[model samples]
Target: MAGLLDIAPLTEKVRVGGATVEVSGVSAGGIVAMIARFPEFRMLMTGKDVDVASLVSMGGDAVAAIIAAGVGFPGDEAQEAAAARLPLEAQADILAAIIKVTLPNGIGPFLEKLTALLAVKGGAEALAKVRATKSH
Candidate 1:
């Protein structure tokens, strides 16, 4: 069989809702979530309007490519090597963990809490001070 195909181009940052979303460093499921935005990828997922088994076969290749590309991760050679050794299933599990932590019920609760916090006495002032310090 041929070696893994290069999928570095797919790792480029994507724009969603007027904000840049990084797919780099995300798990296999996360990469699927990102790349599945493409109509072709979506088709691959559901085997809808396409050859299901053939498309599913591409799944491993795509995930492997994304991991190998090291999308958003810091340049850590050891981590990369370790990740490379992981079976595809383990990689997917790690990605799932990342997605769970990073995307727990969207921003609704977070924004609500943030709004409440900023409303508290000295909250806005404290944030302002931090921002001002960072700007210097």
Candidate 2:
């Protein structure tokens, strides 16, 4: 019954601050907890443009919290503190790794296509024209 629906959590091994750590894909519960603790996280789920500046302003504490939650250690102050101590590059890598596991389809292809499209001359204008045509 329930066991039939139980799938193992997706996990990845990542190097963080000279240590190899296993990071699990964020679960439904983890998403809920993140939304509860950090309302800004909801923007990502909703496909809204997240304010990067605002998130960065939240500083290391927020980054630590995100890492802890993604690592399946939500509400663990000790774990969060440890994550905060890691170098910024390591933190970014861990976050990227977590996102990779969490998103089944992965965003790399989409981003690459988007970047290519945006690189084209008048791409924004063409997109706007298409949108305008659709609205008419």
Candidate 3:
């Protein structure tokens, strides 16, 4: 008989550059690790207005880490490096796809809020403050 632990993880394919990459929902533990390692990630999961600049400040390393984690290749430097090579827009798309699988309600609402936030004042500076505040 199959058990709960025996079930295969749910996966989705997303395009990055010119390739379709398969990504899975990150595990609870993986999410926790991300939050711990990059506090800015907590803001993203909040489903509130996220500071894009703050996320960007975390830089390519953080982006790569998130991609690697979602792709079920956590700690694989080659995977991370590959992800780092993708354009920022492609990275965002991939992140959204990962969130689709990770969150029960999907990333639709979150992206909407983010879009609205981007239109507001403070932009990158606000995000910088957010990242700074979370670091301490």
Candidate 4:
């Protein structure tokens, strides 16, 4: 998870099911949307001290890596079974943790589609910790 946060090696791969997927960079706008709602995204635009276009162009592989890391289980069957065995809340917790560790700012409001269940279960604290951590 920590490794996923490092955006340097743009070609890194993570195991997902039986095949390997490359973790590519994501647009900076995408990154902002990932951690916060559009209404609140201005913080990301200004707070990060980054060039909007450059940050957007920064890490295409990073997004893939974050998702791959979120679904950490290997093997298609195993990943499916793992997801099935856990309650949606549990899955969200796992997913949120993965995103939090993978992204410098933590999971964005855009991810409410995925982490809505997690937000109900102390998502604030989880996000706080992720925010506290420094990303490379």
Candidate 5:
């Protein structure tokens, strides 16, 4: 059997582009509470139809990919190795670690608190302070 065909169905399953943003976003009502501090992350998560459900579902697949890519014979070892010194196994493990927290319950409280914070403070002031202030 061909390997490309193996991934073809999995590819069709994911409507969104990738897992990082989507899954991370889902962990916070699909808004990416972690990204609230970063300007670029703010921009991406500030959208309306961020598709939290899709992200949560796709997260598992993404994490699996990360783990699979870590072994010596990485899934994309040849092409990825050429671009950078990322070992097949190591990079995958790293990616998996980053995505690990995007789980369901893990993000619920974070989303609620983030919403509360955003409601009171909003993004404008959050971006104001250059240094860590007494009150955020």
Candidate 6:
């Protein structure tokens, strides 16, 4: 109960059968990001410029890519190799675009799978529109 990880802060607000139910939704959705697959940007990114600034100003793909990388999620060589295939500059922007598209209020899902998914999704101009809509 007392150690490096604790769910108390997360659960204190809601309950399952009681007030717990309220927190349950938040907990599952929230912790999924934590327990779900995520990777380190340091590992994922080369730290160069690839259109992230323009993308993040819109605040959507920035959120999406961060999600898709699955910082917490450990993937295989194929996964890392797959991520590496992204153009150095476009990596983060790719995620930003995904987050921009699907997210209504939050970016967790977007951040969770932004990059990897985009590589599969494929498209530059289309991605831009997704992220830009957040501002409008």
Clash count for each candidate, listed in order shown: 2, 0, 0, 14, 5, 31
The C-alpha TM-scores of every prediction are: 0.28, 0.65, 0.63, 0.27, 0.27, 0.26
Model 4, 125: alpha-carbon shift in Å?
Answer: 38
* Candidate 2, 1-39: lDDT as tens digits: 558459777899898656798889677688778777875
- The weakest ten consecutive residues by lDDT in model 3 span 46-55
Estimate candidate 6's RMSD in Å: 17.0
Clashing pairs in 5: 25-30, 25-32, 70-88, 70-89, 71-89
Candidate RMSDs in order: 18.3, 9.8, 9.4, 16.2, 14.5, 17.0
Q: What is the TM-score of candidate 4?
A: 0.27
Instruction: Report lDDT per candidate.
Output: 0.44, 0.69, 0.73, 0.41, 0.35, 0.37
Q: Which stretches of candidate 5 lie over 4 Å from their true place?
A: 1-84, 101-109, 122-136
Give candidate 1 misplaced runs (Cα > 4 Å): 1-73, 106-136
Using lDDT, give the best candidate's number. Answer: 3
Of candidates 4 and 1, the better by TM-score: 1
Ordering by lDDT: 3, 2, 1, 4, 6, 5
Q: After TM-score superposition, what is the CA distance of residue 113 in candidate 3 from its true location, in Å?
A: 21
Q: Residue 121, candidate 3: how far off, in angstroms?
A: 40
Report the C-alpha lDDT of model 5 over 1-136, residue by residue, as the tens digit.
Answer: 6686565221111121243221221223223323432233343233322233323333443323333332222345353343144333434334444334333234445445656776587754553342124223
Best by TM-score: 2
Cα lDDT tens digits for candidate 1, 1-136 = 5555744423334333445434444454654554554334443222122222332354554444434433455334555565556655555544443333443443355434654787685486654564455445
